[model samples]
Target: MPVPCIILASPRLRKTRWPRLVVVALFFVTNCMWAKGPAPATRIPLDPLGFQPPLAQFMLAGSSMLTVDYVDSDHLLLTYSTKKLLKRLSDCPPADQDRVVDGVLLELPSGKVLARTSWRTHDHGQYLWNLGRGRFMLRIRNTLTTFAPMVNLAKGDAFAQRPFIRTERRIGGVLLSPDADLMILETMDPRPSDQVLGDQPREEDKPVQINFFRLISLNGADIDVHASGALRSRVTGRIPANSAGYIAILDDGRQHWSFDFRSYGGKIKELAAFDSTCRPSPMLVSRSEFIAFGCHLSHTPQILGAFNLRGEEMWEQTMTENYVSPSFSYAPGSGRFAMSRVLTRSSLVDSDSFSPDMFGGQEITVYQTDSGRQLLHVDAAPIARAGQNFSLSPDGLSLAVVRSDALEVYRLPELTKEERKAVQMAEASAPQIDGDPSMVLSSGNGDSTGSPERSDPSTPPAGTREQPAPAAADASSSSASVAGSTPTPPAPVADAGPKAEAQTSSTSASQQAPAEQKPSDIQGDATPDQPRRPPTLYAPGEKHGNDPAHRDDPR
Candidate 1:
């Protein structure tokens, strides 16, 4: 607010006007003192729920961040950096040629390992929870280590047998979901080809063959096999690629298959046949979505995929490519789905973005499930690209993105005029300070306007005397010529130390006050009974957006 201009003149003694003049003078003094109540310090506005603190970056042993799993709410089972593990097991060369060292299971914070399982090198791990035997499988050297669930370290291993049961024959990917009394294990094993006839190798290899999917009850009961008996391999394989197939068990014990081509005559059902000879990556089945990896035929190859929840091939979208691979996370309540892509590259800019020869970049795509419309796409800025991940507010109106080693937040576009007004009002009501009104009434150097009444310097009133203004109010005030919109800069000071400190303190206080205020406080007042509610959480492994109907432009 602009400081109120004050004109302090000698108290006139006209009989009728005396009382009115005294009242006006008193009111001005009180208002001026209140207005000058110590200028507030400067502050920085920050989002409450929409801010992400940086996680300590530890370029772990392998080329990727250790895949983390929630053991419960308080603890996480992480395949963290294993240089130490590798150092200790240097003598134990990988039996299967996988470089990933069996990581020591360490309790977070304490960093105490309850047990150590044999290691292998792979990209991910899956936790298998059975009522009778709760275990997790870590895929490194193509070995499956089934260990007791470790929620608390102090409890020790629930039943320690090398901390896990090691499996052989190379299970590239595994999904364990039980239905009724049955527990199904679907592992992707690439098909082998035997005929190397003429120059038709590429065409021969292009034929889509189904991978082996095993259905065994955790309780070891009945076995139901489908298609042409069990799985067989053709011998013309060149590259070491895993088969692409996904298995999902609905609540009613109805098994859904996306890539089980045998049952569907080796044709495209929910899953599509390869666009090229390269075998597709293993399918990922999250709660309500199914995502199958797609391939690109370029130098710096790109990873693509399709998503579907209803297991219908009619609606599927070919997602934008990324450097590494795409992973899906959904908040059903907010009706927003996030496709997180990890960029293993050190550079932020896409190779192709600069040079046509270089054709790879990293990005995270967030889409609105209801409309299947992309809400935002954030490039993985190089500075903090490795560990930085995006987190969203519960309402989905704001997104918290961490990149470039700096935190950035963006408010979602408003859906209604009322919401826009509220946002504007909040910004306008932000705390602000103005210069002291008393400055306008003072003499050339801030001294009292009434110079005719000068008191002795030694016997000044209880408080210090004010300084006079710069010059006579008339000449300076008229020539000042204040601009209409642009603000007047503060008058320069001698030291600038105390003034700067005061400003800083005021800003800090204002910012801190808002920060301390909880989101609930603001939420209660503006709560609206929105008609359509979004989903709160999504199953991690289910494929989403695989249905062609969900795609903006079906391909």
Candidate 2:
């Protein structure tokens, strides 16, 4: 009976089962790899003093920190506090603590201290101008008076005892002409207001007097253009070299006026006037043809606009809610611009919802200059609590974001082949300073010999006037007659601001971990091309109506 039983087992079925099992195994492995994710961004510590957490830590702890200014392409005039002052900030009132304890001329690309000035009483305000040929002017304010000390980096002296200009009026602003030969200072007069009652004057009745000073030589031969006006805020930039004029945006609360200053005699002529619809803040003027400004209609949402030099509207876009302060950076190499803002999303609904918190993050958007087309958008987890600063590299190849603890640099998108060639040519033609290869020679105070060795026709020098390019001839032509045309009202465009969203869902988890994690937490063997997990834009129950499509691929 056993022999009679027929056995039936198919060899073909066994062969097919092995292949199916292999395919299932491959699918599981691929998904697991994707879930692990790619490595996070690389963070470079900006600390030169090896201060454990960075300078921003002491700054946030109520320590008065000095303002940092760029001296040249290779150097930054940085101010720091002594250990004593930093320690007192925690216990003593900020008014009692001395803010300006140390000064150091910092070298760029490599965060090295090139020179250190002798410690002196400073009022936490300083300005720097590169005087070409290894000479730089450092203006430091102590108490009510300001002193301009000259420093020669090649001579190894941090400060020269002789001051260039000593003034009683607080230096409200400093503008260097394109050639760096002429210096203009908007100084605020400290005289008592005529509206004073007895001794103390009412805040609203205080006189707002501004005196314009034009310095011809570094030795302080100055001309005072006694044009007294109340300027609440001012933005100035050099006109194109061919035109030899300066453009400025002056806000006096009631109106925002644009002025053109003739370089020959420091005469200012009003160009255009704008009524206060939104508080307008000028961002940057490029090639004397394009200008950018950020206006705050209210606290939550913002408006960013571009205008021709004639003050004609080019393009306008509306920013998202929860933006702390919008900032813009332009790249001359590619004629592109980037805007950044600190964004927050909250689970709790209240009047103070926009307050920056651990659930906050940062977003950056890039746009083309000609078409206003958005090029790229990137978002990252919260770097700092409230204040976040970012800057584009001179070459426009990298963008650096400074958080409270670390400096996060991301490589920018690749430029077109033509743009790359243009940048290389511009770099080659730029004037090279003697000691520092990175420092380019700028136009020195009325000295024709101090100009760069070879100037690029395509690129404009720093602080130089920029003429409209041939490609923009039509726009400039139309803008030239815009003075008679009424300014167009700011039109808000929906879903136009930065579109990057956060990827993490748990606020507590992100807060507990460092701003940047080790590569092991990400995929160990993943390539840079591998995509990371997209950050969550909203918290558990939060919603944003204006949020653009979430961009996960940074490339």
Candidate 3:
């Protein structure tokens, strides 16, 4: 059954099914509005569980949080904890600790708690996975369980708990494929005497510990990872998680970079060596494309762009010094993805600079995964747990973000041709990356070489994305083009300063690839609150890019 588009919040509202004619008319009208321009976000009241709502502030370690996620487009799961102050003998009153943990299944707009139940511990968030369509897989302690609260709440206790595989080994982390067809369980145990190599003299070279990757098949039709069972005997470390259902062994080696991937129900295949300096991040790999962020280009704008699954640069864009890719949300169905930026307030100085290994973004921007068309730009209050405060629907039609006192629901609009053009052109011009694309850096080393040069938003870009023959066109062309995409050159991006390009190839694994696409850059609309980054000495086209960078670049 299709979820109703009703936004009325009255609890007494009755369910009314619209006739087919009315439904069609409503759809037509809504789309017409979207055709004109992206619609403003709809505001809805939010109900955090506790009085002192811990929605945005749950980031501190040992601090309680109110976690919220969508059960379906119209339903939400709000889990939170409450604590009581035990009578103190002395002066110390223990802080409000998360003592009683519980969850409420909320129906949006109406703000009704359909079902109420207790929840497992709030820690070890990695042990939980949203399996899509209201189902979730979670491992509490040594036991793993799967349940769907949306449908099962009416029949039994906290949805019917179906027991899955349980392992004795300590579960270190759990990851699900992008398609949610399989789960990779990383388990760890101490090094045993039998496994230890007594022949090795070096302590580091000897087996420090043992880690194993156990695969569980979530969907039988897709990759049969369980058939292979536990990967090898004892993995030296955690296996690379490929959400696109391509379980891979990445060799992020210094020179002659290469990696191997196993197709769904097929043999492992190796990719060609990458000579380019850009080392792609494997975090959000799809069957079609991957991302490369500042792999060593310090002088140029820190780049964030997509590439072919086999390691060809498709289209790229640059970001300001403060922009960080902390949270990533991709909708496999709609081919739209979102990334966030975070600015931390530090007591060390009055102004907040970008921090490493942090999760919080001042804005959450959504774009077409393939064409790189900028779809939606939203200003979000920085939350340490920014990942939880917002969610993109699986089908990619709607985006719900947690606001201070309300939930801002934004309907992702399908832009008309003119709108797509305006968005791309308004985003950024083609980026001019000079020098040899090849860069050398130590493994996990902080950067590729370049001076710390920041872009000024007030300046117009070098080029724009054109109508056709697009795949991130070179700046030399009036309209930058990417292969299998139309050219849409960039304009000055507000928050990002100077506009740049970000794009993808049309050849996605599951869907028929588009012939060509014009992509939008990571440039989201700037906000007044965000400080404009100061420009550095080394601008683009300067040789000897090896000069020390300004402190502004977020590594």
Top-scoring candidate (TM-score): 3
lDDT pick, better of 1 and 2: 2
Cα lDDT tens digits, model 3, 1-555, are 122232333322235466666666776787665444334356655545442455333342212254556777788776555454434335222221224456677776676768887654423243345766677765554456667786676666555556554554545445554545445444434234233222323222221111112233434111112211222111122222342223232224442334333332223344433333443333343435445443444323255665444444545665554542245566655556676655444312111332333433466777675566666766554353324457777767777776666666778776557645533542232111221100101110011111224333222233321111111111122121112122322211111111113211221211111111122121111234543221111111111101011112222
RMSD, each candidate, Å?
A: 34.2, 22.1, 20.0
Count of steric clashes across candidates, in order: 59, 14, 37
lDDT of 1 by residue, 122-211 (tens): 332222222212234433443333344553234565333222212223232232321111122222222233322232333212211112
lDDT of 1 at 297: 54
Residue ranges of candidate 2 with Cα displaced over 4 Å? 1-48, 52-79, 85-97, 101-113, 117-139, 142-151, 158-162, 172-201, 213-283, 287-301, 310-314, 326-368, 371-390, 408-555
Report lDDT per candidate: 0.29, 0.35, 0.40
lDDT of 2 by residue, 1-555 (tens): 011111243334355656866766766686675544322244545465432332533322212243233444445454444554332334332232243455666565666666676454433333344443234455554122222222444455655433344454445344443334434343433434232222543222222111222223333321112111111111111122212333333333433433232222233233344333432333333433344344444423356565444445556676655543343455655656667664546323232222333235567666655445565455533232222245454445555554444445555556777656644543353322222100111111111111244232223243333221111001112111111122222111111112113313322232222112111110011123532211110011111111111111000
Q: In candidate 3, which residue ranges exceed 4 Å CA deviation? A: 1-41, 47-51, 55-64, 84-98, 122-127, 156-158, 190-227, 231-278, 299-301, 310-312, 323-325, 344-361, 415-555
What's the lDDT of the predicted structure labeled candidate 2? 0.35
lDDT of 1: 0.29
Q: Rank the candidates by TM-score, best first.
A: 3, 2, 1
Error of 3 at 134 (Å): 2.1
Name the top lDDT candidate.
Answer: 3
TM-scores of all predicted structures = 0.34, 0.46, 0.53
